[model samples]
Target: MESLIDKDRIQVKFSAENQFAAIEMAAKPLWEQGYVDEGFLAAVMERERNFPTGLPTRVGVALPHTEAKYVIKEGISILTLDKPVLFAGMGNPKEKVLVEILFLLAIKNPAKQLGVLQTIITIIQNEMVLKKIKGAKDPKTIYNLINQFI
Candidate 1:
């Protein structure tokens, strides 16, 4: 997974005014690089709208993803915001979360999503890693930090 991800796929301190903008920013990398098809962004956004992906972790994060049928390859587009953005909470649609990080998941295999999300959940629970990621000075550093776990 480490070798598969390019540093450019990881962004740092990006300014996304809202969750949709943030979703677009994160999903762009995968489709632009041919990791997924053009419909991926729309699919992810639709899924997000119907069933939110926000999680109130140690450092808030949103995991926006769609069905495997929409994916051509596997990739995770990561974005860290300049300021926290609002997203409806995953557990409760009526609730909101201030998200600083977004992981746009493109998994070609449906079964893999669970395992990948488990790893993501682990990363979310680890405050030390999230803090390091939030404070990262460059995209390469963020890439390295995520590579350590996934």
Candidate 2:
């Protein structure tokens, strides 16, 4: 499958005051590009409330996404923050995670969600690649690196 990642949607050196801001920033491009509907942001926020997506990985990440109804198409938005934003940990909502990377997704097909999650998790598990992404100098570099996965 062709990668849903778009270099134009990538954010580098981004800093958000909170998780909500991070998710908004990450989803904005997708929204503007018509990959997702207006309800997408609200859906993502609601979903996050019920099921956190933050992962305590090597470089702290959050994978925020909503249901297919909110998506007009499939795409992934990559946000690399300059400062870590607080997020509710995936498994333990009580635990707070300072996330530096946010993967905001718009998946029109529910079946692809699990596969996408697996792909992201696998990439994040590679410490070297994760480190490379964290230290990437530009959005292009990050986009190029992540494009390898999809």
Q: Supply candidate 2's per-residue lDDT for 62.
A: 95
**TM-score, per-candidate, Cα-based:** 0.95, 0.95
**lDDT score, residue 90, model 2?**
98
**lDDT scores in order:** 0.87, 0.88
Error in Å for residue 133 of model 2: 1.2
Q: In model 1, where is the ten-residue run with the lowest total lDDT?
A: 1-10
Q: Give the per-residue lDDT of model 1 (tens digit) for 110-136.
A: 677788888888888999999999889
Stretches of model 2 off by over 4 angstroms after superposition: none
Range of the 10 consecutive residues with the lowest summed lDDT in candidate 2: 1-10
lDDT of 2 by residue, 1-150 (tens): 246887888888887889999999999899899999889999999999999989998799999998898888899998989989889999899988889899898887777888888888888999888888878878889887877887
What's each prediction's clash count?
Answer: 0, 0
- The candidate maximizing TM-score is 2
